[model samples]
Target: MSKRKEKTSHGFLNNMNFMFREQWNFEKTAFLFALVFILFDLTVSFIVIWLPKVVLDSINQSISPAAFITTIGTITIGLMFLKYWSHYSEQGVLKSAVNILNMHFYIKKDWKILDMDYSLSSSAQGKIKIERGHNATSRNIYVNMASFYPNSAYLLKAIIGFISFSAIILVLNPIIILILIISYLASAYVSFLVQRMEHSFKDVRAEIDSKLYYLLEEINHHAFAKDIRAYNMKSWINDTTHLFMDEKYRLENHIQTKHFMQGLFDVFLFMIRNGGGYVFLIWQMLTSDMTIGDFIFYFGAITGFSEWLKQIVMRFKNLTNANFSVDDYRYLMDTKDASKRTKGATLPAYDQPAELVLENVCFSYEESDRVFINQLNLKVYAGEKLAIVGANGAGKTTLIKLICGLLHPVSGRILLNGTDSKEFNRDDYYSLIAAVFQNVSLLPMSIAENITFCKESEFDTERLLDVIQKAELSENINELKDGYHTNLLPSITGNGVNLSGGEIQKLMLARALYKDAPLLILDEPTAALDPIAEDLMYRRYDKLTKNKTSLFISHRLSSTRFCDRIIFLEDGQICETGSHDELMALGGKYKEVFDIQSHYYKENSGVKLR
Candidate 1:
């Protein structure tokens, strides 16, 4: 096998062993069921083969009627029990196993996402790989892990059946048995090759599908609805979809055509194997002194043995495909995010107010020339309220991400209470932050549930209601029939409570306050609201934060005056810093931008901003 193929096979077997280790005791229980079913079914099958011969022989010998009836009844009872129980056990085992494996994969994936290096999730290539790992579940031809156990069991059972039946056929004619086995095996080999060829394009297909998924999301997005209609994007959407669909269609069509031809060859091989058996059997019967019952039994056994061979081959093909999927899944589980360290590190520094300091922090994208942060040195004392203001490309948002531990500086260290941010346990470090972003995403859930983001067992209803009131959302929520329990969705079929932009921002604020993290970061949370409301929110920010160390980012410089300290970011560096009044007195970049924004609002009834 090629290196890649070898890895796929190795991964497949490795994961099977992993499954055993994960739930070894339970797997043995399932395998026990399989063993009983296979053994019983095998015995019943041979009895079936011998039944017709036994009946004919008894009739010719004039056997006792009572004995014959007893024999037939016994065989019939065995067959009935084996047939029903075999199906029941196999399906029951399959369903139970699949559910367990699905849950395991989910837990594993969630853990990886929660603890992975921030860089992996934040970068484009990393995102693609993460998606591929996600697609590894339920994306295989046989639904990834779904086919593995059943296919392996089928192969094992077929092998046992083949050995038992082939012994009978060999005595009749070994040459015929050998030729038929070879032909069937060859056909299966070809089929396996074709299947591997089909799976090769899966990654490319996943990439195209990801892009298409994004476009579909864009079209259906609630915020994009008005712009889509007004901008006449419907046709563009259809045309774009067709462009991608055409490529997918062409690729799939080509693969299906090749598979179709291979399938026909397999059919042709089956015909020759069966027909040749018929021709050989007739000649043997006429030439040899084989008894009528023996002749009939041998011929039937030969055909049945060939069927076992075909089944084993089919199982092999399924096994090969299933193994490739296991490879995909394992690859994802092992993929690392290199931004965090101390894999099992714990945080003993939590619960105290966090002092954040940046020591010559610099950040930039690998592909971009723009340095988002350049040798930036700053201190956010515990219980401080700081605002960061900048132009569109001045990297206010990037700075927030870096400080929040969602993005690490390319160079320099960030000190979290004297310890480097990367050295601290990432999850533990994350527990200190509560961020409300400009584009806050709400789940399709109840209002209170969205606020708390907690399960029922951990819910604090009184605390939730208080946060809602503080965020100025209590009145709006109370207006609804369901109040705090109102569901947010596109799928309530018009029954859902559709929150406005300001309401959404308020909801985001409610969540942040509910979290009560020491370091609260608001990335322009009020940028979408009217000027008066924005000003009101800025005034209330201190109260909401409880004077905890907070970093707020906004392009609207007027709304930032209330913060204790304001930093003006220009060209990826802090060009000016001090209180709003102090910066204005300096007559630097901060003063220039603030005046420009202040003049525009003054000329427009203080309702609009520049």
Candidate 2:
């Protein structure tokens, strides 16, 4: 137990020091001012206690001297101005520190989330970790930072005043100080218990708040507003919110009731403490040669001592709570990015077909026993258009992710041009591939900026126009009010135009063409379009791919006929591989699913099967 306590103490100090350096380096002067002003604030309380003693003694002695009067006046004005300046500077310093730390931590967290390994962000457990990591930032960590500056200083002042006042109480009567110390300690322990209990439930509260925020978002958000109203889910939404809050408040009331009981006991201890001290001090005055000023000084000192002790105790409690946040923040930062572990000495090439090879590669989502890809050994030669056609959940997209280095294999190596894909710098490897996912999304930005995903100054206008023409988005672009500069949605600019489903898909295709990476991945790129529109896009696939190595994933097998080769997947394995004619003659799973799709299309088209 002692070893564990010592380790926790060491960790607290270490994490506090790291936070000071990580955030406060730039605002050292503000932090220093905050510390100094806090000491001044503490000093004024002692001065207040001293002034009354001196003034009362002088009047009792019948000293009517101007010097004494003038001295009192001077001290009064001096202390007033001192307090005012101290307060002004403290606010100034604190504002600077708060603003800087918020920005500094924001930048750090934003980058950390952006740079975190996709494996961590892609899983349910990993997302919870990310939220916890985010909690370690912003306001919870803000309190920890405050503890380092103002709170620590407040604690220091409290300690100094507590000790000084205790000495004065001892001078009056040693037994009195001892009794008060015991009482103060007992009260402090009760307070600590109350605070610790509250702190212990903070994680539970945080989880509730996180879920509530998401639920509220889903209710109020544009994405669900139409559907929710159409479904008439208002009552269900209200019920869910009410149940969540009811549980939260029930837990809160339970803690509050416990604190109330503790408060009663604390009050009893304080009444005994205060009553005992008054009796002791009054008895001393009656029997001993203690002056009137001594009586006043000692009484004020005793009261001040108790106040300082409580402040000190509260400061300790604050530090203990803040340390938990620091621990989480530190843990998150210490977790290394998975891709950073294997950055070999190479940058993947640009403007060349990326030759990808998978040797017994496999992968699965975390917390799942079922494999998504199993022993997936395959080779994709440069400049080959390999169409991956499979049933739903056939690992088509997962295979593309592994080949493009968006995901790493679990058991075997994936190499590109004979060099291990994981060995290359992640940024450079990702730069080699351009992918359009099944879910097409556009940022609330200018049409040109969406295509470029870069600043207008950096964009190549000629190449962008060429890609837009190739993507068949030029006709739609011409219809917009601001032309290339028009915003895609009203989420940003009020005059933004919303595109039709097919137009949005075309815009995404334009983006992929604009990237023109060596490797292209199209996962159900034409899912939003009609059959005729899909065939039109399919006819242009060869032109769009040109010399680049491309992996096209689609459920519509008719599109695979244009590819150089095709692979059919089932139950986490590649079941067949061949061209359309070869698969048809072989009479495999590929041919059977293909014929089913073809027969349906032929019936709809009123055309004979070729």
Candidate 3:
């Protein structure tokens, strides 16, 4: 258990280091943008503080109104130009940073969840919350962090302005400067108190994310609420979703109330600062140390700094809250469990007729003590077509995964041509094998692209046409507007039409036929097809896989007749094995299941047998 945790921690650290290194580029760009904005802010602060004093002096000394207006207007125009430059510079850098970060995300996302170490993948599942949980976690992590820079820049400027004001006041009198410092510290304490409340209020965000994930999954997995209405489950889901939203608002409202009270404290602080400044000014006046213009300048400067100081405190508090999102995003991107099998041995040549030998293999889920596959031993030789037949809950799929190097057996080992499967590079091994499962996955692409899977640029188009012909899908393709060039999903690309269930099966068969791998594994491929299509598909499968190594897993007993050998699996163990004729002669589990299915097919096909 300690070893498992140590490995998980190492994986998380690796992912975190990767995320932060990518994030650094974004941080640099934001820094440049924020630098420019901060400069503009400093300029504005100086202009606003001094301009009022200049205008008031001109008025008392009988200076021309026209001159005063011209000076103010010129300054305002200059400030406007600076503001535009700041805004443009900030936006441009942020957009660039987001693009670079998004590119990294796109490249890394193709790594499958199943490929990671079990402990790491389990940890990643919680952080990234994929599927119905973490799938909706925003892809805008970079943009969100980049956006924080502009606000931080404004906050920095406010701090600088306050410091400048403090310096000027100190020159006026030390006592007055001391009072203002005290008031500022008091205001900061209030901000910290309010930030704690905000932290508590923000706890509902994860719950909101979870609720959104389930709602999305239900709508999509249930076919956009149509199935929900069919089953009359709309009210239950609706109420549950609403409850989540209400809880989110409840938290948000709590934060707002705390902020409002904080605002009240700010107002009171403002009154104290202003009232205290006036008393000091009166003392300065009595001592005959400063001019009326000097009094006006210091008073205005104090007011300006106080307002800006409140803004600074407020932004600092907001930054604290923003860190929650930053941490959440960092956790998702940096979780080490996302990367595994950094290196492995290269797979050997398939020339030796790659035999799969599982010698007492075993496996279990993350927390499970009971093994899913226990001391399981099996073998399938090259050039021999084998069938793995089992009920739904039997470990048929699990066994196939073990062979494909997708899952590592917890105990014992899987071998290919007498070499341990784990010793070979998993990616290279996968390239040598072709697998189609009950869950058919077709990319949204052209019919030809889907068939070729973008792997071979120079495929035998003639062979593809031959496979389509054998699969009996020629008429369907000819009826299509674009034929082979037609898009598989017209809804996305407007090039192809939707395929019927039978047509999809034929297209899938064409894809598998085109690969012509040394070992072809088909998992319940004909389950959705009609008897005629299924029969035709099996014939095509026989022609395509003739003399090549193949493993066909099917519930239909008629399909197993094409195999050179059959292995009947039950409860993760091979209960029976033989040729179709030999199996029937045994008159065991195989005979009972096969005879029943064969009789049903015979009745449906209107065929009679002695």
Candidate 4:
């Protein structure tokens, strides 16, 4: 597992690098834009510093009022317009760059998600889908810290700006330069501490997110929500949720308080920097070494550097937060999926025909002792209909899933025509099997598309018509406004209509028929239909399955009468196997179940079931 983790981590980086490489050219463009923006911003600072000196010198001299007024006015208007254009260009180009980055993140991340395993897919949805989305919208807050920027360039620009400010300060006095340097170092240290606190808060948020997901999944899937409410579990839900929320709230507050304290330190440091520089300048002026122009330049330069330092500190905080997101993204990307074999034994591909053989099959999920199937043995001949009858928890659906290659048995071999099923490529093996379960999911598409499973080109029009009639869906289709072409979901805009449960079941049957695979497994296939439709289904199933091997499961005894043979499963073990009449004559579990069902119908409806 450790080795697997390492391998996945390496692969994840390679995948991320490949995705980022596509934007390398755009990154260069952004770099160029950054340089332009920085130069323009620095130029404005220089103007602020030097222009005050020019004006102060003019004021000190005995100059013509008209000339001085005209010169200063012309200079002010031109500088203001230049500043406006440069700032606009900087913002426009940077915004475009950010948009491109967003596009790259979304498109590539979506691709990676689809290719990932089920666990990682769920993880990505939780983290990248939510947190990453929030972060993307907050790009202005974190872009500097996100590792998206060229950090070396940022450092170089800051150094250059600092040098320019220091040079001006040195001209006044070197003491001001020392003050600015001290304040910057102090702010950097405090910002680092605040970032560590923020990271701890983010970890707490992740735990909250996990608990919320569990609550949602349970509410949506299991009978938990209904049972809970029925048993008055509102207090339990409230307590659990509040406990989760309170911890998250407390952590956030702690982090926020730390951040505010860090900001306070920044405020105090700036005051000391500016206050000390001004006090030294006053002393120098009183001693007659400093002029008014020098004082103005020093004040302007110091103010600009202080603002720049604040921005740098904020950017560092942003970087720290983004790093946490990066860590999460990488962890999700590094998770291993379901194991697959490359050079293992191969399953026999059907040519003339195929047979299924389960030899001492045993299976379980993870490390659970509650095994679903244990030492189960069975055989299915080519083109034969086998009915598997069992009570709810007897692993009937599990058996069919194993046969369809959806799962692998832990302790036995499943063979497709004498070859171990695991030897075949899982996807290729599944392509030859068709299944319909009690629980059916329909795609948001037209009725015809759902029937054909969107494989229009491959659908046989004649066979499609025949299957629709067999499944008793012809009447339902004919009643639709557009017949089979009518959309099955109205919420999808111009292509939609609602479908009844029976209509949906008929469509599911049509899909299985359209596939026309060698093996068909139907698990409680008619459970959702009315008695009349179910009776019609059983009557036609024998004719429909003429040349295919099928495994049918049903709680309704009437549905199994058409099958060639019946296998009665009880508590993960096969208790009986024979034809319908033979099993009844034997008077086993099958006969007992059939008699109970038959007696009920006879008494309730005044008509014999068989």
Candidate 5:
């Protein structure tokens, strides 16, 4: 757990300025409406406070009934207009503008996550920042950017009202104003303590919330449904959920207790201010020459003054809380993009195959100190078919990611066509290679869109058919009711069809082929296929890699026999390099693993060793 940095007033202002500038027109319109509403509200409050005094004065002076009625009626109409204007501006325009502004921030946060450095964005710390940023903009309604405009407007109104009411009370006696200020200051202190307590619980609440969310997702996810039912895990899950729920309840109760204590203290302070002030006023009215109208006016001023003072403290506290949320949002937005997506050297054309070289490349994940790919050096010639054969933890996937520019090396360079790959823009460099990893991910869209990885309008019909045939997915796709136009993932659409594991892998292969890049990488491409289907796919490998540089990774040693060269990885280094016959002749680690696999196959099917 990292300690959060203390945010300075200057940092808060900077973040606020950034947020306002991002949606200047919308924010400006909201602020204008807020200002109009606040002004009208204050006007109405003051008129209501003053009206009683005027009515009493009219009665004592014995004014004409018609004149009194006309005056009161005019004032009443003015108050109604002000109140209506205030309500209309606040509910109709300001609220809608704020809602739109909230949506803008949500979109901006998601876009930042999409555009940031892939290495960082996929890491543990990156996920924490993403969650915190999301919560800042959406979770807490009172302390989010959307509430900033109205809260600030109310703060301004409080300050103005405090000044106006204070002056009116001061005319009666400065001592009463001083006492009211002292009582409110004490109340403000309690509020500060409450705010601090709430802030302290934030991280804890976030952790519990994350756990609860994971559990709920597990309960609802289709993948977990079978296991949960087969394993009779319902009672266990219910108990776990209740444990966390009880913890959350205790936390809420503790927080509410603190709030209740604060409320009690406020009531005490309210009594001292109002009760003491009223006694002083009554004494002055009885002993001094204060009129009935004066008594009514001064009493209203004292109560209004105290209310305004309380608002001043409350609004300031709310603003302080909102500032913390802005800090979280700003922290994520300011993270440096290590991939340099915006500005970098242009990549060379991919008209022919690309040559790749790794020089003393070293890599490790942030959470681990042990190097996963240590000081590795290797090269793949242009237009060569190379095979990477290794065990499960041999760093094959890590090396492929480094070569594809998904992960950068710690202390070396990957040269693309003799130019350092880092010199090219990350997005531009991606255009040179088409890769299919062990995991096959399919989006909820038409099969054609998934293969093309583009919108329907941008798909190349002729090229799509070519790749589908080459990848051997034409038959499977044609069996579907809508053919290539059929949607995937029934969870997203009623007509969507879920493809089998092998069919999904074939679809992924078609997607990679449609890219038509200079370099192609297949990582266990036939993992889900039957043995015969896998052999058939491997036979087509030559046709697939015919004019491009290709790298094939697999644990099945026999499947890689046709490659021009094979490399065996052990302990994060290239332990052996040779063709299939050459490695077999060596009778080293490669031959040993191959013979074991051959023996198993011979026992199972009585097949001759290759």
Candidate 6:
């Protein structure tokens, strides 16, 4: 148990060092200013403690009234100036430093999430860590380095004050000093118990908070507004929210009860310490040659001693809580990303079309035993348009992710040109391909910036317009008041336009086109469009993908006829592969699905099936 405690102490110190070093690295001047302010503040506090004793003693010494008045006035003015100076430092300098430190951690957390491996970031455990880390930084001010530093400084002050007061009281009566220490120690133990109880609830509280936050966010989210009203889910949502709230309330009430008990214990200790010290001092004054000023000074010292002991206990509790937060944050930041590459061979130049080969690649999700992609062997020739067709769970999208290096294969090699895909730097390898997934995400930026994924200065305006036109989004852009410069996602910005689903898909296509990567992968890219728009997109596919290798994934089998080759997937393996006519001639599963889909169109319209 001692060894465990020692290890925990060691870890806490290391975490504190890490936080201090990072804060210093973020803003050196702010760090130094904070330290200097702490020292100055501590000096002022010590002076305040000693001033009363000095003034009372001088009064007993029969000092001249005018001289005493002058002395008091000078001290008052000096203290007033120090007070305002301290306040200014707190409001102006310290506040800005705290904000900067918070911003640094916020940015660092976001960077870690963005830079994490896709596999880890997408997992349940990783998401929990992310949420916990966010709570660690945001839930309490004491968790912040700026606040923690000041707490440490105040703790030091408390220790110094306690020792100074003990010395003064001990000079008169050693027994009184001993009684105060024992009582205060008892009070501190109660505070420790309360703190431990609160800490134990941290995880449960975080979970409840997370649920409440999600429910609130979803209720207010524009995306969920329609379904919520249409399904009449207001009462359901309210009830769910209240349930979590009740749980949180119960937990808090329990914690507050413990605090209340601790407060009662503190009051009991306070009476014992103060009452005994007063009785002892009274006895000393009556029996010994203690002056009136000495009595007043010793009484004040005893009261100050009690306050110092309380401060020490409270500060220790706060720092311990802060240490726990630091541990949570460090856990997230220290997580190893399996996909990260420190150094690797650069990707081949993108001047020519890229060839991709998957040699018996296999993969499974971390939480599942069953493989999602099993022995998936395939090759795409340079400049070939390959189509992957499958039902919802047939590993079509997983295969695309594996090829894109978003996911790593469990057992086989994925080669780019002739080199293993893992051999190339991940970011450099990513630059070779542009993909459009079913889920469309648009940043709160001007339409042109979204397309080019660059700033206004870096944008190729002509190329942006060309891709927009090619994606058939020219009409939508022209209709908007700001044309291509209009901001998207009104939820994020005051003046932003929300596009229709079809329009957003077109925008995504334009983005992919603007990238002009050697390889393009479109997964259900035209899912949101009407049949006519989908047909129009397919007709222009060859023109858009000129001189580039492209992979098209769609459940609409008829739309893939334009591809050089079509591979039908079933149960994590390829079931059929050929051109449309060749697959139809073979009468495989592809032909069967194509015939069924064509039958629906044939029945709906008088025209013959294509």
RMSD of each: 3.5, 3.8, 5.2, 5.6, 3.4, 3.5
lDDT of each: 0.79, 0.77, 0.68, 0.69, 0.82, 0.80
lDDT of 3 by residue, 1-610 (tens): 5632322333423443444466565455655666777777677767766777777777778877788789778878987887788678767555654664455443343343344444444432442433312321245533343334444566777888778787887787777667766887888888878865554433245547656666767777634567687889878887888887787778778778887887898788778877888887778777986767677787777777667777777666655444444444444444453212446565556543467788988877555565667778888887788988877767888788667666677789877777777665556667778788777876677788888776346667888788778767789888877787788776678665788877888888787777766678888888877666676777778886765678888887777687889988877778889898899899989889877777656733624455
lDDT string for model 5 (1-610, tens) is 3465632223657766865666465555666677788899889879978999999999999999999999999999999999999898777444644565557777788999987877888776777677767777884456675566566777888888889988898789999989999998888888878877876776677667777888999999897999999999999999999999999999989999999999999899999989999999999999999989889988888888888988988887777677666776777777877775666676666768889899999999997887889989999999999999888888998899899888899989999889888888888888888988877778889999999988888999999999999989999988988999999998897789998877777787788888988999988878767655666676676677687899999777887788999999987889999999999999998999988888755533435556
TM-scores for candidates 1 onward, in order: 0.88, 0.88, 0.79, 0.75, 0.90, 0.90
**Candidate ordering by lDDT (highest first):** 5, 6, 1, 2, 4, 3
lDDT score, candidate 1: 0.79
Model 4, residue 80: distance off in Å is 5.1
Clashing pairs in 6: none
lDDT tens digits by residue: candidate 1, 1-610: 6745533555556777865565554456767767776887787778778988888888878889999999888878878888888888777567656765676665677678666776676566556656666666663325565567777777888999999998888787888887788888789889888988877876777777788888889888777999988999889989999998888888889899988998899899888888888788888889988677877787779778888998898888887777666677666667665555556345534345678899999999865777889999999988788999988888888889899888888899988777788886677778889998887887777888888988756789889988998989988998999898788974762567788887887888889888888888999988888777777777777777765788988788878777889999977788889998899899998888877887768622456544
Minimum summed lDDT over a 10-residue window in model 2 is located at 1-10
Query: Candidate 6, overall lDDT?
Result: 0.80
What is candidate 5's TM-score against the reference? 0.90
lDDT score for residue 219 of model 1 = 83
TM-score of 4: 0.75
User: Which regions of candidate 5 deviate over 4 angstroms?
Assistant: 1-3, 6-10, 25-27, 92-97, 193-197, 200-208, 232-261, 479-481, 538-542, 599-610
Pairs of residues at least 3 apart in sequence or in different chains that clash in candidate 5: none
Better of 3 and 5 by lDDT: 5
Report the lDDT of model 4 for residue 546: 69
Instruction: State the lDDT of candidate 6 residue by residue for 209-328, as single tens digits.
Output: 878998999999887999998999999998999999999999999999999998988888888888888888899899999877677778778778888888998888777777766766
Model 2 lDDT at residue 562? 83
Alpha-carbon RMSD, candidate 4: 5.6
